[model samples]
Target: MGLVRLVVILIIAWLIYSTTRRWLASLDQKWDQKKSGRSEKIETMVSCAYCGLHVPQNEALQAQGKYYCSSEHQKRAESS
Candidate 1:
């Protein structure tokens, strides 16, 4: 009876350990998938026409066929 109780406890412990290991493995796999799935492309860079500062083209302010680092610079350039 004592041996049977020990065997049951061991089985229960093994089940818990295996379940936790599987859950952690799945979480790790999901994290890798999320990182790889992003696959973000490199953005083109443009220089600010006013200050010659480099910024990503998508983030730069464009006016009169020129790119500026900020709106203030763009406004100043346009006003002049």
Candidate 2:
């Protein structure tokens, strides 16, 4: 009877350990996927021709075949 009880306890412990390990592994994979997905998004970097400041291409102003960080920079570059 004692041996049977020990066997049952060991089986239960193994099942719990296995389940927890799988759950943690899955969670880790999900986190990695999210991080990799974010890293996969590539953005073009541009430098402000006037101030030489770096900015994302999407946020920069386009003028005269050059990129500016703002309208002020654009105006300054155009004037110069």
RMSD of each: 4.9, 4.1
lDDT of 1 by residue, 1-80 (tens): 99999999999999999999999999999998877755432247799999999988778999989999999999988898
Score each candidate by Cα lDDT. 0.89, 0.89
TM-scores vs. true structure, each candidate? 0.49, 0.55
Residues 1-80 of candidate 2: C-alpha lDDT, one tens digit per residue: 99999999999999999999999999999999998866654346789999999888778899879999999989987887
Number of clashes recorded per candidate = 0, 0
Worst 10 residues of 2 by lDDT: 36-45
User: After superposition, which runs of candidate 1 have C-alpha atoms over 4 Å from their true positions?
Assistant: 39-80
